[model samples]
Target: MNSEFSYRLLPGLLPYYAFRVCTKFLQSQDLILPGVIIGFLANGFNIFSNWLFIFQFELGVNGAPWATSLTRAIQFIFMILYLLWRKDSLADTWPSFSLRKLSYNVVKPFLTLAFSGMFSFAAEAWSFEVTTILAGLLGTIALDSHTITLNIATFIYLSFPFAVGIATSIKVGQLIGEGKAADARRSAIVAYGVNFAVQITLIAIVWPCSRLIASLFSKDEEIVDLVASLIPLSCIFMLGDAVQANTGGALRGLGRQKLVLLLNILGFWLLAVPFGAVLAFATNIGVRGLWWGFTVGLYSAAFIGILFLVFRVNWEKEAFKAQRRIAQTSQ
Candidate 1:
């Protein structure tokens, strides 16, 4: 079983890498609609493929991940088709493939941003992986419940907030590069508003349909019940996730990813995980306690990003710095 799982994982990464390449290119170009359309299409394809593989072919247990991998590959393929059909947009950017002059002076700043961005994102993601480990300590049922609830939350998150955050990043960077500080700040506000509204709508749906939602993932009564119970907590955490995603987008645009990095580590590791460990082991709260702890981390961690963007930042000064970066990069 272990060897089979590992083998399947190898195939999974290929589609994931392809999806990343296409979506990242689209986002970098500020072409939000193409990426969003591709995402919805991929998810729809995933559903169809899963049904085909699992029930139609009797592939059973391994069908879902395989379906997912196929969908990811399809997404990139669809993207390539879109680019080919819409020759004008790609043509504008791909007029020629050229990597302008390279130097340590030119490369160092980008390397700094890349490392900081990578670590900041990795820390939060790894912290969540630790929660999965902690849930396993409670036994199979708890782990199953945690996995289902997380999958649901992730689906909702990626559906909207993720896209909004990317748009926020691209828009802010563009406005700042143009030396329009106030407009960049306004763009940040609009992004926050959109994310907040979308998340609230999702929470309202999830809170009432918790059981129905849980049933979609599993049939076992215990797992379904546990997931329903966890769904509310997931909604609570969703609040934090929305805030963090939105503000983090702006921070990434601002090039303050190191600050984002420190806050996530402190919030998730120091505050959330420890609190959850104590609650889960010391009290009768059990697996739900772990989620409560994550909730704390999400809200607390996101607040710092808010503070930096709202209270601390000088908009005009930021614009000047962005202009300077642009000038340097262009040179």
Candidate 2:
């Protein structure tokens, strides 16, 4: 509850939220290196604060959440200061005078985007959490294997295509905002190509090093063996995962927030969870079945996302929508 409250309090920092979008906008404008530096600094502050509170103050586990809250607060302050310092880039977009003007135009579209985007991400996260719970039901060894494999997979994901997705999202959105629909489409295509190449390369590395990687996490032969087997499956999963993630990013860029939200729900909750549950319980495959179900769902989402991007999207219309949204919101 305390953690939840701290997270809830983040939206209260209006300027921070604005600056986050502004930073993404800036990235789209080809000013990405600075944003990356700032992001690194922010992450460093988060880690440093955690260390300070946990060790220096001897707060133990409680220190971690407090550190998170503190880091976000500091980030909010830093972003606001940065915006003020670089007023030229943000001055036109920044709201002034009546709060009503900002609320109706800017805040409305933002809320629309935020709510849908939040739901879309939440659906994916919740599906994974549900899978974890199901893994626990399998037995201690199964759950441990699942935990270790998931942690490693998540780490690899954060290290690679995840960043590409974010960068692509910003690039595509910015291009749309500027009415460069063709460029936005081209950016999405390039993002997909890059995601596939990187994921495939990582898959090769992971496949050969699976046992070694698993051993680093655990000394137990049984646990390590279980994790090693799962790694190959996870590599396969990454193919679909990379595609879905980047495609989702592209959809977000196109302001198809509601569509993305619907797709996530259909893919994860409607398809993945049920299929995984069935495979886990009704079949002899046990934990592996669960992962297979997850793979199927991911591929399902990836296929749908790719199809939408290639066949259904109207780039010009999306660009117009982005323009209207920003125009209506800005002072």
Candidate 3:
């Protein structure tokens, strides 16, 4: 088994994983910063609250797990309270206690979320997962270097998606709400522009310091060697990453979850994973092969995601009209 298996698994990991997944809901609704503070504080509180278990019983590393769980629980609780208090922002527009309403309110949003939010995460995660697997097959130093590059790329990527989500969520929601087709189109363009500007700035900052950042993860000569060789690829990878995420956000705003899901599966599973596996194991391409796969898949997803957004405009309008008809019938 992998060294990190227990890190991703274990009963204690669930709450934190759930918090990460559910936080997107808050983000799409514009509550992330406050939620993060509450989450961090909750974690701090959990450590304090569970200090008795650590000190009195000496549970060792296990006590840390309990502390993490307590944090997630408290974070979830706070989020629930916040949502309930801000009922207008969080509530379903039409109310009913029936199963049908539940399906519409919770199930649909969740299904959309699974594809748009979770599936996208899965695509990105699998890219890293496969990298880890491939690196393991190669050697430990290769694995260390791969992990280093992946972490830096991830940190750099965190900026674009949140900004993209802001534009996509608010503008698309408003456009759909008011039947403004031109505005919907403009919003997508605007999101892309914003993502482009921000991502370019990040690339400029990191590209020159790429080796410096990579060196931070490890001091081993072999690991550092691998990282230095991969820095350029990592920079390219970041651009593709930005495009993929922001385009996915645009689709999410357009409510095209199925399309987004299909695009991700095709891009990552069909194209990236298989090719990377072949090059990483069957050939002598090494760690860079894994990143090459990442670049290909991300670029493919970005292109396809953009195409999906373009085609989805009419469908989005139709969805709005259909909802309007339902409302008219009820009236």
Candidate 4:
């Protein structure tokens, strides 16, 4: 329901939006459009490759993941090559494998990302695992229904985070490079706004035809019924999902990934999963109780991500300064 939901929209688009705002600030549009075009192609390359793998291989559900991973590797290689060739665009982008510098700059960030990503992965993985286990306890029918609804929900979950990744990578990278604190704040705002608008629009479009969406994953009538019943909750889950994913990405851009990881750990491990266990196993809410636990966890992480960002302003400045000092010292 929030407006200007940029973060939940598309990560690729955020760079373009940031460029537009940044160019306006500098009164230059000539390079902005071209840069955005290149960025679009850059993003589209992997997407196109993914489609080719899927369509060509008939990879269906599982094929998509492999295709995506392969395409991402290709994309990474392409970006590396492009950056190498276009050295001017990447001002000192490469890093030396020095222990001292690595310890100070890259190691903590990498570990933070590892933990944060694991926690993020855990949020859903824990719920899905719980659902499967509980479903087994309930009977094959309940398990099938749970699986059907979850697969559909999983597809839906992919959209918001992709958008968030792009927004954070672009906006944060630009702000750090140009030292635009005010615009960095605006970038976060714009991301949240665009994300809200896009997601709400998506929900409206998807809500009326929830059954149709559910049917894509399975053909079982009873499962379809369960899926239909759960569509509203799935939509609700995505709202919190939007907040957690994009906000996490924003924090990453601001170099507070460690805090995000910690929040994720506490939100999912200590709070959401435990609450879900109590609700699903100990209460009468049935499988729906499990989902409620997932929802609670997502909302909790989202709230923590926002709070983390709010308190991270000075930290962002300091991170940039530290990076600059390192770069200067290296020179």
TM-scores across all candidates? 0.86, 0.86, 0.78, 0.69
- Among these predictions, the greatest lDDT belongs to 1
Task: For candidate 3, write residues 1-331 as lDDT tens digits.
Answer: 3434345235546666666655656665556676668766886797685785567668655566556666677777676676667778667542347655554545655565565656766775776786688788788888888888877777777646555655575566556656776777777788778777888888788878766876787777778778878877888877877777767766666666666777788778887777777777777878788878877877888887777667645755645763674465344
Shift of residue 100 alpha carbon in model 3, Å? 4.5
RMSD of 4: 9.3
| Model 1 lDDT-worst window of ten | 93-102
lDDT per residue for candidate 4 within 225-249, as digits (tens), equals 7777777777887777777767876
Which runs in model 3 stand beyond 4 Å of their true positions? Answer: 1-36, 40-60, 87-96, 100-120, 166-170, 315-331
Query: What is model 3's C-alpha RMSD?
Result: 4.2
Give the lDDT of residue 306 in candidate 2: 85
* Model 2, TM vs. native: 0.86
Model 2 residue 53 lDDT score: 84
Candidate 1 error regions (>4 Å): 9-15, 40-71, 81-92, 95-101
lDDT of 2 by residue, 279-299 (tens): 988998777777888789888
Ranking by TM-score: 2, 1, 3, 4
124 in model 1: Cα distance from truth in Å? Answer: 1.7
Cα lDDT of model 1 by residue, 1-331, tens digit: 6666556556668767866766666667777788778888888888999999889989886777778777877887888788778778577555343466456656788888889888988888888899899999999999999999989989998888887887888888878878899999999999999999989998998899999999998999999999999999999998888888888889887878788788888788898899988898899989998999988887888887788788899989999987788788768
Best by TM-score: 2
Query: How many steric clashes does model 4 contain?
Result: 17
